[model samples]
Target: MKILFMLRDPFYEAYPTFIEAARELGEVETLYPDRGIEKAEIIKEIANTDILVVAKVKIDKEVIDAGARLKYIIKYGAGYDNIDIDYAYEKGIAVTNSPGQNAESVADNVFGLMLATSRNITKKDHEMKSNHWELSVGHEIYMKKIGIIGFGAIGKAVAKRAMGFSMEAIAYGHYLDPLAAKELNVRFVTLEELLTTSDYIIISTSLTEKNKGLINQNTIRLMKRSAYIINVSRGGLINEVDLMEALNQKQIKGAGLDVFSAEPPQNALPLLDNVVATPHIGGATYEALVRMADVTMTNIKRYLAGEELLYRVYPQEVRK
Candidate 1:
């Protein structure tokens, strides 16, 4: 058996334990692709591989076809949109992801971004470092309304955290579980209501075809001028150009973005004084990395032993 790990730079160093365990099962090879992996190179490396472990690399039909021995594709973290799920399914390649493994890490990041943006934490720190003492009025999240865009594991975790701050939590998602919301003390609301009413709007949903660029000019217009947007999920969910314009016009207070429409965005949104941006590190904590690695390894072992796989991603789920 052969296993290929297509882990990108930085991430390649995050899973030493997983790599050590995989070696006990098969011949393992790990590649640290620069920003994006070359398709031809991936095809060549994956040709004889029985399983492929991917993070941030796009696994499309051409590469899938080249993986003659491929039987499984494992996503290192929660988001599997980077992989071509439909194509992999068509090729009889079972795809699985480590959901909830990074929920706490990402949920913590949600507040980290929220507090930093709301309180001008980063801005004040920069100013202080420059030998200038200035005080800026910052918004308080206490007793404020927070609208979560997705009601998934990460979203639920965020809602749980909101309770500690005495904030009201409301969520909007394609799939809503009333019981879950009731337990978390979150109310389900329409996208418009979430935008208009929330003091802090959080995008914690998956990026899908139906909702791509969901946060555009029209949606931004529905939000309160005092409101702020914080996205810890995929960048494609928000239209960068529209967000930049809204931020520039002060139509909205500001934004906290960990993910961009493009990784290392070519735009000036991150450069804006009101915006606080990070390089997609919502799930980069040591604990989360270890949890994700453990899940990935368990699924691989389950697949090898003919046991039921965990977190198996279905085509219909992604299509919706």
Candidate 2:
């Protein structure tokens, strides 16, 4: 059995263990490409692969069909939208993710973006270094309305930090559990209500068909003009063009985004002063990488051992 490890980077902590374990199962070849490989190249690369381990590279229907020897596909993180999960499952290929492995790391980054945008921290720092020392007025997180969209592990993590700052936090999730909400000390509110009321909105939801382009023109209009929007989730959640227009028009105060529709932004968002964008490094901490490495390789081992899988998210219908 051969395993082709298609990695976006080669920095996972348990890298040697991953290779050794795969060798114990069968032959293993790990490929780390700085640029995303094309579909034809991927098919050629994984021609003999029995298991495919990857990061955020796209594995569409063509790739899944071309994966003739693929028995399992393991993702490095929680989100698997980049994979054609349903079709792959239909082809009898197993898929798994390391859910919540990097939740706290992402939550920390979310709070960082929140504070940066709310207080103009990045702008002020730039101005100071450029020899302008004028102070920038910013709002406090204390006693303020903080809306958390997508109240999963990452969202709850942010809520915990918000509590430290004495912020009144509310949350909205498709999978809302009354007990969980109560435990987190967050009230459940409708998306509309959250939009209208929150002073700082942190988006931590996974991307789905229902919520794609969620924070669009109408939703932006619903938010307070002074409100700040922060997203640490997938870039598709917000309409980038709409967001830019809103920022340019001062529709809302500003936005702090760690993810964008096109990473490296195929556009001019970074050039905008009000928008603070990072290279999607919200969950790139070393600790998170280690946890993710452990979880992912463990799942690969599980597949070989015929044990029950961990953090399985695909084929929900079949699981039911």
Candidate 3:
């Protein structure tokens, strides 16, 4: 059996996990494309693949068609939106993800962004380095309202951390569980209510067609002018141009974004006094990567052994 490993980059730190998994399964062929490979190239490489592991690489219908022997696909992280689910299903391929593998790290990053934005930590740090800092007013998180979009693992983790700061937490999601909300001491609210009332808004939702461009100008207009928006979620969740306009016109107080609609935007967008940008490091922590790799390898091993994968997506769908 041959397994094609398509990674966005070479994760040398996690190579041992892959090597071990390969020894237990079959041959492991690896490819690291600095730039995303085109569909034709993907099809060419997937012709003999038995199992495919992908990270941030598009696996559309054309590529799936070329995988005559492909049985399964495992994503390195929680999100699998990059893959064409309908096409994978049609090809009878099982897809799996390592969800909750980096929830703690991502949640921590979300909180860090919230604190930095609310307290103006980044701004003051820049000022001090420029020799312009005297004393700057910073906001306290205590007794503040925090709204979390997407009440998934990471969202729950963020809410749990907010408890330490004595902040009230509210959340919105399609899969809102009343029992879970009660247990977490989080109020369930509509997206609009959360946007309007939250002093700090943290987005942890996975991207989908419905959620793309979720944080548009209309949504931004509903938020408190002094409120700060934090996105540790997928970049597609926010409309870049609309967000830029909001920040430029002070529609919302500020934004701390880890992901952008187009990663590494070609033209520099204005970073206002209140804005902070990060290069999508929500799950890039060393500890998180190791944990994720372990989980991913375990899932792959199970699939190879003809056992049900722990995090399988679209497992029951009948395929062509």
Candidate 4:
């Protein structure tokens, strides 16, 4: 089998074991298209590939058509919105993603942003470094209410951590599993209720066409003026313009964003004192990378062995 691994990160260098394992299965060709490689070049590279592994690269219809021998497309992380799974399915290409592989790391980041934003950790640190002994009062998360927008693996993980802070966890999602919520002691609530009541509102859902700009001006208005917004999921989930306006007007207390509407955002949200932003690194921890690599390799091995694949996402009717 010939495998094409395309992503900006140097995965093989960071995890030599993964490349070694992949080599055992087939001939592996890794591509580092950091500055956006041309589509024609990508088409040329994928011409003979049997298995394709991707991170954030778009696997649209054109690229799918170029892969004459492609059998499976494995997303290195949880989100597969970048890939055109519908077209791939029509062409008999199976697509899968490593869901929950980085849930623990992302959950940790959610709290990191939460504590930093709520307690003014970064601001105070900056002041102290500049020889100013500023005493800015900050809010405590203890006994506070946290509203989770998506009750999936990452959302459940965040709820589990909320328990340590003695915070009330409530969730709003399309697919809220009652048993799972009960196990985590998370209450189910409507979106408006979650927004109005939560001290910290977190966006942890996947990005779909139906909910692309889920958090907009109208939704922001529903939130408490003192409430903070935290997002560790996809950037497209929130409308950046609306969020910036709300922050500027003090509609919300602050925002802790790991993802933005545009990566390396063109806007000034990152420069705002009220916004604590990171360059979408919620799932970039070493531990998360190891787990993601394992899941990717497992699925590849399963496909090669003609066995049942885990975390199959495409061909929705046959998803398992």
lDDT of all predictions, in order shown? 0.91, 0.85, 0.82, 0.90
lDDT comparing candidate 2 with the true structure: 0.85
Candidate 3 lDDT tens digits, 1-320:
88888775646445556566665678878776655566677788899998888877778787888899988888888988888887787777888889998899999998888888877798888888999957877788888999999999999889888888888999999878778678878999999999999999999998988789999989998999988889988888988888888888888888888887776654344366777778777888778878877887787778767887887787224422
Residue 92 accuracy (lDDT) in model 3: 78
lDDT of 2 by residue, 1-320 (tens): 77787765645333556567667777878776556566678888777788888887888888887878888888888888899888988898888888899999999998888888878899998899999989778887778899999989899888888888888999999877677677768999999999999999999999988789999999999999999999999999999899999999999999999998887689987778887788888888878878987887788778878998898767657766
Best by TM-score: 1
* Lowest lDDT block of 10, candidate 2: 10-19
lDDT of 4 at 214: 92
* Candidate 4 runs further than 4 Å off: 315-320
Supply every candidate's count of residue pairs whose N, Cα or C atoms clash at under 3 angstroms: 0, 0, 0, 0
Residue lDDT tens for model 1, 87-162: 8887788999999999999999999999999999999999999999998999899999999999999999999999
Supply the TM-score for candidate 2.
0.94
Which runs of model 2 end up more than 4 angstroms from their true locations?
A: 10-25
- TM-scores for all candidates: the values are 0.96, 0.94, 0.91, 0.95
Q: Write the per-residue lDDT of candidate 4 for residues 73-167, one digit (tens) a residue.
A: 99999999889988898999988999998999999999999999998999888899999997788999999999999999999999999999999
**Global Cα lDDT for candidate 4:** 0.90
